[model samples]
Every structure is written in structure tokens, then in C-alpha cells.
Target: MTPPRDVAVVAYARTDHQGPAEGLSEAETLLPVLHEVLDRAGLAPGEADFTCSGSSDYLAGRPFSFTLTLDAVGAWPPIAESHVEMDGAWALYEAWVKILTGRADTALVYAHGKPSAGDPRDVLTRTLDPYYLAPLWPEPASLAALQARALADAGHTAGPDPAADPLAGPPAVADGAAAVVLAAGDAARRMCGRPAWIRGADHRVEPHALGLRDLTDSPSTRLAAERAGAFRAPVDTAELHVPFAAQDVVLRRALRLDDTVTVNPSGAAAGPLMVAGLIRLGEAAARIHRGASDRALAHATSGPCLQHNLVAVLEGDA
Candidate 1:
């Protein structure tokens, strides 16, 4: 297969992520971050060739919630834009593809969530199958606990190993938003002194039926990493979207991360729901841009029990 074009993350900005940021509307929370990333890249609002975002209406409690947040981007110019209901990592995927296609030299990606406004776990139930799982109305905690028990029964040890039990970790909640800028080749080198070039990126999904899945293993995650070329080279750092301890174990195993690779230095487990994945990607890119790591891996997950997974490999100019 042909290799994908090289696209780099030029800049990224995110909100401080208060436990449950009070008094700040979703747009209010994102506006400054929107401006900050562009300013960091020395680009004006609506200056990018394309713009995309990831968020959820279910969390926002209204239809077209994503449209409301466009006010932060100053949509007056009617720029090329798009939105995804999934985590911002997916939105970043869209923007990356656009730049790779040669249709755009630069792009902007962002994702936000006010999950603290409501029961975030309960909100997640909506992603379940309505014919079966939805009726049970099981919260994420219950599902994860079940998965953890399954892992333990299967004799999987939890730790830096891939089979760690996510349910073993403490529960946490946070509210925040994040944005990233993308540029291709020359545009990328010009925007950022040392761009974090996207070496590979891909995502995969598994059967939604929890009964059909081996809760102890994440085949989908491994598949995505393989397709994204994550194992083709050694990674110095990894920013995985591990909300629980087991997930950390599962993803590390799935991606074949060894002891030499650093994992989750930003404490992504405590970040907001819809935005954490993008933050992981952004953080990994930042480390590469700063010469902290020559190669990095970023992973994102969606759906219950890690049903869906995305992986991106980044490398420095060297």
C-alpha cells in the first residue's frame, strides 16, 4: 500500500480543565483556546484552509449543539468547517486527511465537552445498542467493573503490562476543551520550528455486543495500531486515552508498548470525556515538537469497553 502524505501538528491549546467548570458556557470555554492556538501559529481566525471539531449534542442537551460552539471560531467568513459527534481525535483525523489530500495546506481541529453539566456515564449509555444494551441502562462503571472482573478471572496482571485492569483505578471527572493546528510539508515546517510529522494514523472498531467480546483483550486497538504503523518503529513516548487502569494495560499490550516508552504523563484519566483523546494527541505532538522525544504514539478510544480505537504515530524532523 502507498504511504500517506506527511502532515504535522503545528500548534495546540486547551482549557485548564476545572473539575466541573462553573459559569462558563461551552462556547465561552472554547473561545480563548480557539484564538490561542491560531495565535501560536501566527494565523488569524478563519485563516486555515479547513476547520473541524468533535463534540456531542447528548452532552450539550440540545440538537445542533456543535453549531452553537462555532461562535467561538468567528464563523462569519463562512469557512470550510466540519464536526464529529465522537471525541476530538476523530475530528483531528478529518483535518489530517484534508491536508493529506492536497486540498488544504493548513487546518484547525478542536473538541469540547461540558460533561460535568450532567451525568457523563449515563450520557454514555446512549451509545449502546437500543435494542438490548440501552434498555439495561448500565452505566460505564458497571461495564468497566465487569470487564475488570473478567480480566482478573482470566489471570491477567494489571500494571505497566498490557492486561492491566482499568476498573482498579479511582474514578475521576473533569471539564475542558482543546484545539490543534495542522499544516502540510513546507507549510508545517514554516508554521512551527520543529513540526511533529504524522507518521501514521488509523482507527478500528469491534463488535458492539459486550457478550461477544473478550473483555480482557482489545483486538480492535491492536489492529488499529498495526494499520497505523505504530509498531513499525520504536516510540519514545505514548499518550494513551486511558480512562481506567485496565484500559492503560490493554492499550499498552495491544500497541506493544515496552518499558522504554513513557505513558500518560498528562493524567488523561482526569480529563473531560469528549476532549481527552484530542489532548492526548496534542500532548504527544507537543513533546515531539519540543525535542523531548524523537518518536511518539497517541491513542484514543470510544464506546464501552474500548470498542473503538484510534492510533497515531508521530516523529520529529530528524
Candidate 2:
């Protein structure tokens, strides 16, 4: 069977790097970027054929946080929309699927989270299996530490003191929001001056049980990257959602990205958050627009110990 035609990311936007974005509701934090993305795409809110968003109610200390953000979209006439309790990158996947199915020619995707509202480390316990794991209070960091140790023992990582531990180093939590506008073929041409054609995109999930997984290699990420067709096509840059420093190294190996590929020029100063993965997409698109890179790969991760992952390969026209 012939592969589906490529879709394009026409525009993207993100909020200022800030801590705990207090005093503003989720709607408030998301509204400006929503409008900015529309404007960047040269389209109106009502023009999108479909809309999807990613967010977590637990982070907001309340449920249905995404429903309120609908007000920002002015959904009076109603629109095709969906929500994921995952990151915005997953929402981008949903949007891409919508376009691929011939159901929608244009889509708006957004994601937000307030990691500052609660003790992020403590709250991460909810991601664990409630019946068997939650009671143990295995925070996300500790689980990551287990994986790091496993990698170290397997020689996938360095450092003589394998038992010294890695998670005790530092935390990478932050707060932010991000949005992107996508369109297909002619619709994409009308939306932006320079659209980054999405050559391929794919995501994968590993078993929830930590013991059942291999820590030395992220099979899920490798599977997703392979499905994304990035390895088949040349990639000039890779914007990966690596919150922890060590995970960056792990992902590089999993994706088979060499030093020639530009990685995370944003650095720790940018303060990545839940929307970081989506921001990577936006950053790649920006590189295309600026002619800084011709082809790029963007990746996002979800769940504890990188149990879930997504990858998208993007390219530009000369």
C-alpha cells in the first residue's frame, strides 16, 4: 500500500519560560498562545478543521482543565476537538491521525501543565500502578534512578560508582504551555509562508511494569524513531524532550543520532516542562523557517521511566 501523503506543521508558539505560572488559570495561560499560533498560521480560530489538546487535571488540582480552555477557542458554533491526559506531542499525534484519515485538512494542537502547583515528585506516584505500586510511594525520580543504575550496570552509561545513584542529582520539573497549527497540502500552503513538511511521525509505549522492561535501551523510543522513518531519511537536527541530562544520552543511542546532528541548543536555561516535547516540534519548524536546518527530528516522552515515547521527522524546501 502507498504511504499516506505528508502533513505539515505550519506554525507553533510557546509561553515564556516561567516557574509555577501562578495567578493565571489554565485558560489564561493557554489563550495567548492559541491566538498567537492562529495569527502565525494566518488563520482564524474558527478556521481549523479539528482541534486537540493535552493536559492533566491532577496537575491543576482539578479535573476538566482542558474544557475551560475551550472558551479560549470560542467554541460557540462547536468544533471537532479531543483531549488527552498526555503531553501536547501526543495531541500532535492525534491531529496528524485526523489529517491522515482524510477527516480534517487543518488541525490545532495544544498542551499545558502546572508542575509548580503541587509537589511534582510526590504527585508522580499516581503514574504508578495504584493496585500494586502506588502504595510503595515509588516516586518517578526513584524509578528513573533504577533505570539509570540498570544502564550503568549494563555498561550503557559511565561512572565507576554505579550504586552511587543518579536521580539524587537534581530535578527537571517546570511549568509551561505550547501549541501548533498543522495543515495538509494546499491547506498548508495557504496557512504559512514556510511550512515544515512532516515527513513521518510515530509513538510507542512500553509495558507499565518497570521490572519487565530493559533500562539500557529504550525499545519504545527506538521503535517510534524507526517508525518515524528518520533513520531512512537524513536528519540535520534533533530536538528531543530529554528532561534529565542522562536521558539525553540514552535517547541519542536509541535514535542513533550522531554528534553531527544538533541537539538541544536551548539548554537547561530554557526550563523544559510537560509541553517541552511539543516545543521541540515548534523549534524544529522554526529552524526550517530560518533555513538553519533542512531536515530535523523531534521527540517527546511520557509516563515514568520513559515508558511512552513519540518521534516526528520534519523537512523544509530549498
Best by TM-score: 1
> What are the lDDT scores of the predictions, listed in order?
0.86, 0.80
Provide TM-scores for the models. Answer: 0.95, 0.92
Best candidate according to lDDT: 1
Taking all chains together, the TM-score of candidate 2 against the true structure is: 0.92
Candidate 1 clashes between residue pairs 3 or more apart in a chain or in different chains: 162-249, 164-246, 165-246, 166-245, 166-246
List residue ranges in candidate 2 displaced over 4 A.
1-3, 158-166, 169-172, 269-273
Candidate 1 C-alpha lDDT tens digits along 1-318: 113677899999999866888899899999999989999888999899999999989888889999988898889879999999999999999888888789999999999999888887777888898899999988887888787778778877656443344444435667889999999988888899999988888999999899899888999889888888888878999999876766666787788987898887666453788898999999999998888988998998888889998899988988
Candidate 2, residues 1-318, lDDT tens digits: the string is 112976899998988855777687777888999999999898887789999998888876787767988988878788889998888888998898889989999999998887887887788888788888888998766777777767767776642243334566546566778899999998887777778988888889999887788777799899888888888977988888865555765788899888698886555412444687788888888888777889999888888877898989888877
Give the lowest summed-lDDT range of ten residues in model 2.
Answer: 157-166
